[model samples]
Target: MDAALADCRACPRLVAWREQVAREKRAAYRDETYWGRPVTGLGPADARLLVVGLAPAAHGGNRTGRMFTGDRSGDVLFAAMYAVGLTNQPTATHRGDGLRLLDTRVTAPVHCAPPDNKPTPDERDRCRHWLVTELGLLAPTVRAIVVLGGWGWQALLPALTSAGWQVPRPRPKFGHGVRYEIAPDGPGRSSLHLFGCYHVSQQNTFTGRLTPAMLEDVFAQAKSAAER
Candidate 1:
């Protein structure tokens, strides 16, 4: 699945944009070869918890080849995860940084870095299959999912339905610390706990919209829920 995802070129616009960024190169990353392709989810298949973000940062995951690596957002996120015992370390600089997620996996709805950090509805739809497939595979063990930002929250709901969870009418709204328990639609499926957190973006963190303590609190709740 990872290999197939890394080689996906289903979205033409995303294909061009990712390659162009890799070719031009960010000045600071000029010496480093960018992964350029779609970034895959990181963690064990049997992870009990999941973290979903909007997409990779242009120069962060696209350059380092790992989600949440080489970015300020990741710094804040990993620190919070570590505080809640979700990770082995509080720093994620690169793929080989020896950082490990404990009973947790991180992924995104859109695999590639989108322009201006926003993906078109069409692009998101095209990429929905990957997320649905991932969710189906993780259904057995994943009990909780923390969605970072409204975009991810919105994108994830439909995929959850597709993966066998029943979303309630008048769909749940996204907000910091909002949580919902979604019942499974099938015999073999299990209920899922969905959580909302402010994205660990500079816009949120730089302005103190999302504090470390706030993020940690959310993760701590999620950790407890996952373990239960």
Candidate 2:
């Protein structure tokens, strides 16, 4: 799956943008080579916790080839996960930085980096196949999903439903610290619990909209749910 994901070129716009960013290179990382391709999901295959983000940052995951790595947003996320005993370290500097996640896996709806850090709806839909495949593979072990930001929340619902989780008709709204439980379709399937958290972006972290404590609290809920 990882190899297939790395070779994906289904979205022309995203492909162009990600390659462009890699070619131009960030001034700070001019000497460093960039992955510039689809960043595959990372963590244990039998993880109980799944974290979904919007997309790879142009200079972050796209550059390092790991989800949420080499970015400020990743710093906030890993730190909070560390406090909650989900990760071995509080910083995600690079792909080989030796960080590990316990009972948790991180992925994104969009595999490639997008322009201006935003992906169009069409691109998100086209990229949903990867996320759907990932969730299907992990559904047995995954008991809880922590969606970072409303974009991820929106992207995951359809995938979850398509994967056989019974979603509510009215649809749950997205908000920081919000949680909803979806019962499994039948016996032998694990029920899914969803937790929403503000994206660990500079816009939120820099302005105090998302604090360490706030993220920790959310992860605490995820940990408890996964353990149950």
Candidate 3:
């Protein structure tokens, strides 16, 4: 995650976008300093499920220096993790919150915050290599993944497909609760599943597009897949 954070010069546009967001403080965010820098994602090294998100929020994780750590998204995410017994710390506001991930870990397609909360295709593509490496590292014990949006799912699909994970036909398009099992790689635990959920961003939750139940159901499926 650190290496990816450091080497992420992916989208020139995003690099520029981050710089701009860092420069101008919107009226609503007077007290907040935008963490335009790459956000460090957190998860267990031996986690069973990997959750993927779109990107950091300009004032949220981007400001907090930890992926999904200091935002409304983190609030919903950790709340669900605690509900599922997947997180030791009930809340994660800072990097030093003594929080720990249990069976799940969260990541994003891009490491930096994209202005207006949009990651360019180039940025997502560029970041794919790191995710591929991460998947390779995590695949041994990982049973499933929960993609938080269509963009995240698209960003991750290539790597999973290359790894021989199958996408069910009449194909499961991106949406909350959809699941796919990556074909078994070998004699040893070979299946990996991809589950879909709406991005737990401020827009979704604040706008009531997603709620605690929506978020919990995704993790519930993940818990089930991990246990199976």
Q: Write the per-residue lDDT of candidate 2 for residues 6-60, one digit (tens) a residue.
A: 9999999999999999999999999999999999998999999999999999999
Best by lDDT: 1
Please estimate how well model 2 matches the true structure, expressed as its whole-model Cα lDDT: 0.93
RMSD of each: 0.7, 0.9, 2.5
lDDT of 1 at 29: 86
For model 3, the superposed segments whose C-alpha errors exceed 4 Å read 23-35, 168-171, 185-189
Candidate rank order under lDDT: 1, 2, 3
Runs in model 1 deviating more than 4 A are: none
Error of 3 at 115 (Å): 1.5
Worst 10 residues of 3 by lDDT: 162-171
Better by TM-score, candidate 2 or 1: 1
How do the predictions measure up, each by TM-score?
0.99, 0.98, 0.87
Error of 2 at 56 (Å): 0.1
lDDT of 1 by residue, 1-228 (tens): 888999999999998999999999989889999999999999888899999999998999988889999999999999999998999999999988999999999999999999999999999999999999999888889999999999999999999999999999889999999999999997667888899999999999999999999999999999999999
TM-score of 2: 0.98
